[model samples]
Target: MTNNQPSPDGILRLINGYWATGIVSASATHSVFTHLENGADTAADVAIRAGISERGAQTLLDGLVSVGLVGLRDGRYRNTAEASAYLVEGTPASLSSFAKLKLTHMNALADLPEVVRTGGPVKQVATEVADNPHWAEVVPAIAAQSVPAATIAADVLRLPEAGAISILDVGGGSGIYSAVWLEANPDARSTQLDWEPINAIARRLLEERGVADRFTCIDGDFHTTDFGTGQYDVALYSHIAHQEGPEGNVEVFTRLRKALKPGGALVVCDYVVDDDRSGPAFPLLFASEMLLKSKQGGTWRRADYHDWLIKAGFEDVSFHSAPPATLVVARQRRRPVL
Candidate 1:
């Protein structure tokens, strides 16, 4: 655990990492964080209120406290600020549903050995598109995790309050980012493109924020949809590019660029690998998760994005730091007609 030293072996960490993951998962699974936030401060209170055995309650509480995710004060347990900020229920920052979604993803790992042998995921990641309606919960939960990042992205774009400025949110699930941008730029309008169910979710978010009047909701896939040429002043690819491979991304980037008025920005925020691709950990593991989840999706390199953006006739590319992922900002090349 030396700072600046290489971590222990990969296999060792992967084997035991689930211990901590399970701890957080169990606490969230049993609504321990929610109960603590709602005033079930002691193990007995949590046990009684949550309908679990006192011994089981205490075990879970102690495990979370040991991991610094929970704090103890005067014999009462409390969620640490980090846990309250990101793990509690009924909050935009809450990732509780994301945790549950990943828990379901974990169910597929039992077939990993065969997946490796076969060179494809034996089990694909589940979706609302499946018979289950659970994605109705998961997509918004995933979007909540992106709100802060997307807010920063909007800040980077520095849009103005002009009705002439039009933006496109490609695969904008919850419309959090577009809603944020529209909030900032009252006169500007956006078109949110995604699937039918996801667009329904986005419409609700926009309506709740009172910005639905200014934003258009279109239900379709970005790959197949016709994003009108020279119509958009800005285009956002928020967390959606990670689902596309290099060539697929190039095609989408080309379409997004074609949609943008020359000099308009194309903003991409997604889990990406550094050029070395050695570690930053989450993105690397997310790459593997993508393999299991999609027929063709994985984290890619910064160079890959840079090249693809350029190939799509984009220029003035710049990188900006954001948490967990970086923003690749580029512009459609401004060329005069001959």
Candidate 2:
């Protein structure tokens, strides 16, 4: 005989999800992964380097081992491959900052029930308010997450071969796309439009990457700012669409269409859901974060994007997969031959 009843194991794990979050966050905050990568094999070594008690370091190491982010053998600890690649402090794809950022965002989950009931965030942190301090911290952390997707987008567009191209990055947080594209095509120049505080952060990051010479910033709200006419060869709206409603997105797309030169491409990298509102897991789950943080934001469908792009005077709209996100590329229609 077999039981038909569902097991409580899944429910238990869901409720205890914060345990995993806390472990990762604490480990990142204490630089456990970095220390491990730097030859700290014992908890004592890690504790010495991280300035924590040996017992505490041991417990944290055990927690990390349990989560498969760290490995333990012969009573010694080491960062797992994934941890070394992404959790180390200065790796090209480091996510240490992103993990630490989540520790701050985790507090907002407590208000989910109220937010759902009220149909909006109780107090929005993901918006443009003059000198919004949240952007200063969150922007750089998210830039790491965008690196892979930005590289993919740049490759797909053959940015390296597209010499002397002009790029317009709308609401370009942290300026990762610009950095990647500029690095790929040394002759390319990119402009970013965003809040002044966020632009300040982007300037510092681009300066560090040595791409500041090719990058410029327009410090203002994108909604009110003029994108200018027929100016750019490529335009990017990376990771900003989900924080807006349909009308807002359509309006922005219209402006971006005008901002592009004839036949210019606009690349929108975002967590786009399926037409039927089914799951690719992460994007579907990310909708909850948008709901908890934004007044009118959610993972939109591909169909929604197609409709908006078409309505906004774009042609050849298509989608491409860049895991954990999607790229919706649309082109401004070219003029007819005489």
User: For candidate 1, what is the lDDT?
Assistant: 0.82
Q: Each candidate's TM vs. the true structure? A: 0.87, 0.94
lDDT of 2: 0.91
List model 1 lDDT by residue over 74-147, tens digit each. Answer: 89889999999989988867888777666665667777677666665665345314234765877776877787
Write one digit per residue (lDDT tens) for candidate 2, span 211-319. 9999999999999999999999999998889999999999999999999999999999999988888878999999998888788889999999999999999979989
RMSD of 1: 3.6
Residue 192 in candidate 2 has what lDDT?
A: 97
Worst 10 residues of 1 by lDDT: 123-132
Tell me each candidate's RMSD, in Å, in order. Answer: 3.6, 1.8
How many clashes does each candidate structure show, in the order listed?
A: 0, 0
In model 1, where do residues sit more than 4 Å from their true spots? 1-13, 124-134, 160-164, 333-338
As a whole number from 0 to 100, the lDDT of residue 8 in candidate 2 is: 86
